[model samples]
Target: MENDREGPVPQNGSEGPVPRVGVAVFLLRGKTVLLGKRRSSLGDSTFALPGGHLEFGESFEDCAAREVKEETGLEIDKMEFLTVTNNPFLDEPKPSHYVVIFIRALLRDPQQVPQNLEPNKCDGWDWYDWNNLPNPLFWPLENMVQSGFNPFPID
Candidate 1:
């Protein structure tokens, strides 16, 4: 197959590539969802889901499970595909783009408490009411909220 994507364009001597793929796990327990205080340059100080860039050849479920375990030390029992977001941060100070896959998941052990496994990337983890998420959410998350996409929908 011919590659449709052009080569990385030079931007101030740095190569800029296409949108990277990522996964955001919505770990739900009752009416609450798990979120972490981001501590990195990108979206710093915002409360966001536990997730990261997806690796080549890995399934979305696998990426969500791995990211949840790595970021919060909790294991996901099962997950369902929620939605996909095309996030372009052209106006942000650090312009970037990501194709984010959102997944709603349940914990393998209900009693398993989350821990700050990646202190460098996140300050800590906590649960918040779905209707009242903390201030300054990551761009994709903010977009989701504005679009009225609820991770927890009653049957």
Candidate 2:
């Protein structure tokens, strides 16, 4: 028997292997969505939604707002929880499990623009037509697509 070091073992002294909670924000601008090119070690160079890990005792909306501001320098409102995806990245060298909370949100102001606040973590942000997304999407995003999750409202 061997223990897989998917990620740093928990320091809490529990059984270990705790799943991390990630909040994926979908900033919808009409028929388009906002995406950023990840520069982080996990999803390097892949296009992903604007979101990050859910902090201790923080509500989903709070996490969404914070991550959006931190990642894209944009404020968001009217957050509606779209769906949840369980992503297990066990095949990668640094494997881990993530319970991703997909949140569909809108810009607080229509004219507010996004900036590369964390240039080291991500490239600049861009508006993308949901139907015409760029290739090599991040794992959770790909999971959403594969599950046929649509951010748009049904007409």
Candidate 3:
């Protein structure tokens, strides 16, 4: 992947290879939500939602479950669509991904939610009231939470 001052470029079939993709699931509980701190070297050690890339042949919902389980070890009772933000930061050869797919997920047991992975995916895990979540939630979660937009349809 060449790094020019501009950004990334898609490779021609005769030139190189296809790009890799990733996804994110923003699981919400009541007025509170879940966020994961990046212990890995990928992001800026910033705090974000619980999610990861899509596996080959896996449905988006399945991938969402997998990521949540891998990171938080909790099973999501339900999930609803939220929003998609196209990350406009990339350079040639190395394709930058769409970043994340936000989803509002309902957890069966918010009080009993546990982190199964050791040392754990993040250094810490805590639930925050959507009205007053910490300011450092890297994405536009605060705005979304405030809007009261319910993606899940009620019968």
Candidate 4:
């Protein structure tokens, strides 16, 4: 396996063949959820949940909490496993793959406003009503919607 400063080099000499494991958090407040516009190469300008690659030895719940805090600067209180997705961006201009673990969580402080801690990776954060999400969602999110995976469920 070839390795680079970034990480392992894919056999195809593009990205990596190993599916990068990541965690996405759906931070909920009432009927709205928090979303950020990605600024990175993988899904630039697309609306995505706050998340990143899972660190080695980190539990999914811990990764979700950590990523939410790191990316949005908001602490999460409770988190539950929502779903998992195997996203293969073979048709994308820049092909890649990911094994994404989705987790549903609530903000530790309901009144706290999210800040963009990493502007290089994300433009900013905004709350959108679950019923009316923004267009051009990230591929995994688009798939999630098409598959009838509603993040918000009536309890």
Best by TM-score: 2
Report every candidate's CA lDDT: 0.80, 0.80, 0.56, 0.78
| Worst 10 contiguous positions by lDDT, candidate 1 | 1-10
Cα displacement (angstroms), candidate 4, residue 78, comes to 1.2
Clashes within 3 Å, all models in order: 0, 0, 5, 0
| TM-score versus the correct structure, for each prediction | 0.87, 0.91, 0.68, 0.87
lDDT of each residue in 68-135, candidate 1, tens digit only: 98888899977999988887766665566777888999999999999998887888999999999999
lDDT of 2 by residue, 1-155 (tens): 00111253465887756788888888999999998888766777889888888878999899999989887789998999988888777776677787888888999999999998888777778999999999888877877788788998789
Once superposed on the true structure, which residue ranges of model 1 sit more than 4 Å away at CA?
A: 1-15
Model 4 has how many clashing residue pairs?
0
Worst 10 residues of 2 by lDDT: 1-10
- Model 3: how far is 155 from its true place, Å? 12
lDDT of 4: 0.78
Off by over 4 Å in 2: 1-6, 9-11
101: Cα error in model 1, Å: 0.4
lDDT measured at residue 153 in model 1 versus the true structure, 0 to 100: 56
